[model samples]
Target: MNRSTVDVTFVVGYLAVAIGLLVARSNPATTYEPSIYTGTPMITWVTFAVALAIAVGMALTCRGREQALGIGLGAITVTGIVSLPVIRNYRFAGMGDALTHLGWTRDIVAGELAPHELFYPAIHSIASVFHYAGGIPIERALLFSMVITFVPFLIFVPLVVRELTGPSMAIGAAAIVSWMVLPINNIATHMGVHTNSNALFLAPVVIFAVFAYLRRRATIERLPLGLSPFSLLVVLSGIGLLLIHPQQMVNIVVLLGAISSVQYIVRRRSDDHPILDHPTMYAHTIVLGVVFGLWALSNERFRDALLILVVGLLTEDVGSGAEVDQRGSSLTEIGGSLGELFVTMFLESAIISLIVGVFVLLVWLGRTRLAPEAKSLVNYLAISMVPLTGMFVVYFVGTPTMAFRQLGFIAVLLTILAGVAISRGVGTLSNYVSRPGGTAIAALGLSICLVLGLMTVFASPMIYDPGQHVTDQKFSGYESGFEHADEDLPHAGMGYDPYRYDHGLNGVEGDGTLSGATVDSGTVDSEAFEDGDYADAYNGIDYYFIMTQYDITRELGVYQELYYSEDTLEEFERSPEANKVISNDEFRMYVVSSTE
Candidate 1:
């Protein structure tokens, strides 16, 4: 094959691997796939094969700069949106704020007209309206929202980076950083089924707003497609962010504002006026803030917090424990962590990414010559650090865990900037090298960065194990033949307790005979099923093993009821209202709606 063919093939292969990394966590068995890596073993293999095929296609179709970039982004967008159907079984929006989304649907179905959680009033309220329109289920409506929101990053990130840097750098940077940011492993694994997933949609919109605002103020070219309606678009995006997660929305605004202010400061010092002085900047900011603020007022919590922060009476706490109340953390902490969460997303996931990003950025800074425009870009990036630092200060006052989670967006932006820096570095070095030498040098640098990034993506999935959490209320604990009840508990921060519940025998049962079985060799469908006895007769009843409840509430993560037979189980006539003795293991066991 010719050299061009070889390069194209390599690109295709690399992209395939990238796609695998993106969906590696999706579970196939469940309607809401959750994280494949976290649930069914078969799902991982399926996702791997699918990702590989897509990557190969990307490589084969590689053409000129713009087309190649478009293809790569299009792949992510298509896959992300297509994956929505995977979340079919999700209920109550699937999890966290998703509950609010589902709650919206419930109210609509019942013909009630009110909101649920304060955190996501807008999304929930809008979802209610959609349900009233009468076509999709609550789950489908949220999934649609997720898919629609996911598409822009595919288009906007590359476009923005290209505008700021060059086409080649833009695409490469977009790919690397996106790999870190988009499917934040921890969130996808344990939490995406919850309301937290909806907040992620706002990220791309926020980035797009910055891109549009920057272009409006900085670029001399004719207005982009969204520029004419920039203020409206930004307002909408802001409202979305606010409705989904106000704290995260705050982080985006603060970070963007900080960057703009920095650019303005540096430019003014240099006797220049880049976009900071433009009345349009302030106009966009005010309108966006107002629209979202009005929506936030619907939630009393939001209104109170906003009043406290805006009035200067309350600043959010920074370094409290994992169980520290959400009100303790500032708006900046919530938002900033979303930006920075990529690194510690799940142990080593962020480490490899951070190394690659830092390496690339240093290389670029050392080797590349910065045009005045690039310098301005650098200045803006530097200014972004200010609010990030402020977030750190907030961390000191409240929860360190808050800082940990907020790093997702920051990591992406940082990694992308680093990649751009590397490209510029290569370009700069080329200026000094003879033609042949420059080509060789640039090629070498690109290959190294790409290799490192791919390695990080592939290895990230390994950092977490798929074992279920077992505890007292859920199961009877490790003594009951369930493995990993005590392992990997999130003792320090507000993280998931990766455990599963097993039936335990009772103190509360009147029949006092517990019967159970170990089914399937880890596969409930297989021959590993066997009967066993529990010390307490009431163990035949259904239960839950909540890792967070046990650890945080310090209560039994397992619970069982007394039973005499399958049809006639004994009940405690006056067993007191269920209460968690320990706040950490605050879980309780109850009859399940269904087991299949």
Candidate 2:
């Protein structure tokens, strides 16, 4: 197939993906328990397969009729996969954080909650606007805001590439990188409606828009209103970024600051550093920093959080959040968990990094052949690696936001480098292979590796855990279960994962820790399940809540702790001392029958 034929195939494949999403929506009574992974029809993955093939075709194609539509293939693929749980469940997307965010957005829409009270309120505010004004549901509206956040990234990343490489393969490469799920690096940056994620999607646009303004500052100033299109984008996207998540804006500012400072140093050394000739924008960096500092100072939550973190850093354990002694597990158990964790990390990050790393090497080899702007970009990325590693270390050692978003910033840097490499690589394909068909075959071959690798990050893991999505039924089970319980007394559940039970409890269990007792041994004895002697130490264990998450957790051995299952429940029931207190379709609550 030639360029035109491949472009047409790209359009057809994308259409199939769209149709697949609609067709794959879960039945209303879908039981998310046993496995949402297996529940997905094979057709869904096939649609993805088709998408990958066509994306490669698009990457290798020249000018074509579906250029615009095809350029967004990557973004569409990302937004589509992210939307699956939301559309299928017809509810929310993320596990616990998303639930809280949706609730926040709802309150904002109802005018019961003001945006200023929250640390990062841009997403809630935007979702509220869509919900209240556009008459969309807060859940749908919030996710729509998140998934649609891709539009700016879709538009600007290629434009940013164009600024350096001047069009062609980079446009397609930029879209393909979107599919790479680079910035959505870890659970920290969830592939759903989220504040940090909003920043993730907007960072490329904001940074490039700033660069665009820098390149045309003189020309922009001469405009009648002194605001060009790119200037408007900087203002709008920058403010949106500021309001959404200041931490990420801080990260972006640092990157731009680094590049601008590098640009200044290069200009001082002139011809000696032509590769570092990217335009400087000290004013832009300073303004962004000042506005961020002001917001940080004014926002009590952010201020207090930072202050506490700093004080804790100085006075207490440098990384108290990573305490293993407190996990109530033996050193061996902890070591095993750490090993398993490394495996997950390797699969989640290392696979993509290997691919990007190869491309980055290609970029360096072809550095002299690159355009000046492209050379500057390559230099910026190459130089930025050392500092970005330091930044990652600081964040990785510092906070326990549970989102590990710092890594995503580093991925953004790599994604850009990889985009440049792909642009150059594709144009040079004729040297080694034929034009469109051979190129498409090679691209598809590469894309297959990407799709398989990205699935590890984007989709629910096939084995370790079930879906993280909090379907309406699960939400109801939690709401009604907790409501029916005695809040006056303490209780425990099988799975006390920070994410698993919290969304169900709807923040009633702050941080989602178990309330009952000192039974941190993966399995704690209930008053009935244990003898009077062993159970006497922690008599506060009144009720035991057993749910499907517990069943699954025990089944898969997904947690370092949280070992309870049907066998345990059967043992509890067999005890003459056990009393069945509350039972629901999704949850079971029991206490000592002999006691009050």
Candidate 3:
């Protein structure tokens, strides 16, 4: 189809999906909670509607389909942002773990005026305003934040590629890239991974800035033009990204700049460094560094990480957090916190990356020969891998905070690469497929591949037998320091990995290693071990709820090690103070009171 036809199709498809999302969410019988609704008929219907719309718009916008596609993406980004506060108000509703934390963060940050407490203060501040202006409940605002976060990539990815490869190739690449699901990339979109939000916004802003810098420099080179607004915009975008999530913005820019610097260095050796000679590039880099540097210095964690990396020259292991141990599985881990990096990438990121890789490889192989520009595109794409590797490292080593959320820029890069690869592959195949009867065969093959893939993906949700609605079942288990409902604990102290127990039915036996310990009232101090103490002493609010879950599995030795020891344990086990043994389908909830 032609451009106009494609635009019409895109708009129409998007509208239909919007209507479906509205209707499904509007349903009185459904709460729109992800856990309860995820595999339900309502969710299925909504997914189908949304996916259909996305597919249509995507197909129509092929070959640098920026305008229509960009709007659709922007709309979603707005929606995610709006959802943030709503999720918070209805925190008890299980939208997902990510949604839960997002909701909590939104409320606490808004109420306490502690956006600074979050890893990415800027994004949270903007989100806070969005929540306040809309008069949305905290829960909904959280959800909205998630929706809006996805917008920039939708617009920026196609635009970036189009600048390099022309509209047709851009469209083809986008279509192919749109489907990949990389590891821990959700840090850009989800509430649970708030730090990623900063990264999400920053990545695109940087790209837009880079593009503008290029334009302004070209103007100066050709016509001795005055300072272009494009360069200003680039600088502003970098500032915005830094304000929102400086740490991620810095990491992303530095990683890319390092590669670019290498290119410049190589050129300098041969006396041919265009990027170095270009004042625009130089200005963009310098300004970005300064702005992002200031932002980084504002946060303790970011400041510490940076100081350790650049000034102190501390080793990665010493500076990293414990989470890094599980970022990716062994298969995908690249560098830094090798063990955890592997877990994070393989378990969380691989799906998206793998799908994109396959399609992009096809495009690359099909091209047969690469153009000089294409070769440059390939270099930039390769440079992106550094940040992607960094993401794996951070996922395992560092906390994925709102400031870190923008790290998903790697997701955008991966998507772009995949798109480029696929377009090239299809271009290559077009030659052989043009023969008599060959087009028909190729079309049939494509159809079969698509159908099979969809079937495989949808199979789990489709065949899942809906059992009796047991939403109110009592999850129970009694442990040492405290008592808890079974629903709270998961196998091996992994706590609840929502990915595994999506429906919340299966009960994993608590290992009691860090769980199932019993604390005697005399062994611990009442003031020290009190629930409020955890919050006061450790900024322990986040860990408080998680510790409560372990009460059911805590045993003598296990529970005794707790700082609060006896008094805290007694408070958990006995009560007129809300301590009681309440049993449910999976586990029992116990109210306890303690006397130190």
Candidate 4:
């Protein structure tokens, strides 16, 4: 078939898959079911399987570089869209960090700054702009924001790989593999903390620009009209990173610092000169760091958080022991088993990519002299793994799951390395055979490997079961309870709303009022309501909005300590002074008459 026909067919197929997934799944407010592939309904699985087959077939059959690139790009687009249905169906505009982000965005759209004591406001500001300018709903604005932040990484992976290794099938392979590989942060599928996700998206672009500058292909020299376009882009990206996410800015700085340090060390050892001796290269780094530091210091909330984190790290008690206890045993107690650690790291790193990355790194290290560009690239990759390794060690000490975010950067780098390794391996194998059939056989073997890798990566969510997604019933209940409270309570006259709960409510003003308040099942202590203490505590609030125990346990498992037991809920329900105003299977609203 002609290239245009092939491209058109892939586009049509991708749209069909996207539509099918959206239609097949029930809305988030309906029922909670296991994921599409993991649960029942034979047709859903069959449709997904067919879509995968088509994507794989097109990618393997493509003959030209352009066709291959199209296939790769199409596959990434389809994968992203397929996951969106689940994200959209999430009850009450997502769960966990997603809900918090949604709340921030809502406040921003309402033209209120400092809505919450949030460190990163760029994502919310961007979403607010989209909501106002595009006249779209908040949900759609948030989803579109996610898409915008995510698409850059998709575009960058292939382009960067092709640029580094030259145009070949390896670029297509790298693109598809990296897109499919499960991110350690789970940011790709689950919409939480858009700042980190956005930072990740911008990472490769910044890296490419830095590399270009080093190669002398781009510089900060001024033209007759103005500053060079390439130089302008690099500076803007650096500033953008500073504003978007602090952690991401730190990650980028560490990455750049590592690269520069390695380059300097290698040059000194080999009697070679620095690639970019101009002051502009260091200027951007210094400006970004200084601006971020000044902003953090000026903001009291950010400064306190930084101090707390620093204290926790220094004390070696950064995270709670609950996570470590959940892991069965502490790494320190076991003396850190290398075999077990390797297995855990491999699973989190996308197994295929990790294996290929290690193999390629070893192969490259064994060789003697190499081209300057190749050597520099190899050294940068090696140094990039250090921070990830440190995070892995921290995971063992405490905060096992949180370490996955650090591993995400490693996964991206490894996927690219894997692609290069596969391409070189296949090319070497093809040289030994005399006929065209040998190349075909090699291609078939690689295709099978790629298909299996994709399947494994896709199945990870089901196998690990992170429980990031919540059922429609529970989410709706929690949302309804909050909405009822907001409707019943007096609107804020000039300042923050009086009614509050432990969690951040989307439309509520001021910070939550349930600070240090504890509840069991659906009830708090009777003394909490006596002698006007409750009213004084909640800014003269008389009504308390509470969620059912089942819903709380299911949806907010991480906040279990904040919930009351069933016995406590029943005890409170029987109290004479507390009158129930609204009651449902999912939530309960009570009014303390004495407080009022």
Q: What residue runs in model 3 are displaced by over 4 Å at the alpha carbon?
A: 1-16, 28-119, 179-193, 215-226, 259-263, 266-280, 304-370, 384-409, 435-578, 581-590, 593-596
Better of 1 and 2 by TM-score: 2
| Tens digit per residue, CA lDDT, model 3, 327-418 | 43312322234454234333324544664566545445653365555545555566556655665565434333432343455655665665
List lDDT for all candidates, in order: 0.42, 0.60, 0.43, 0.52
Q: Report the poorest 10 consecutive residues by lDDT, candidate 4.
A: 491-500
Candidate 3's error at 210, in angstroms? Answer: 0.6
Q: CA RMSD for every model?
A: 12.7, 5.0, 11.1, 7.6
Model 3's C-alpha root-mean-square deviation from the true structure amounts to 11.1
Better of 2 and 3 by TM-score: 2
Per-residue error for 325 in candidate 4, Å, reads 2.5
Identify the runs in model 4 with alpha carbons over 4 angstroms from their true place: 1-12, 15-29, 32-48, 57-69, 76-83, 86-93, 114-118, 185-190, 219-228, 271-281, 316-322, 327-350, 368-372, 391-402, 428-511, 514-596
Clashes of 3: 126
Q: Give the count of colliding residue pairs in each prediction.
A: 91, 1, 126, 5
Query: What CA RMSD would candidate 4 show?
Result: 7.6
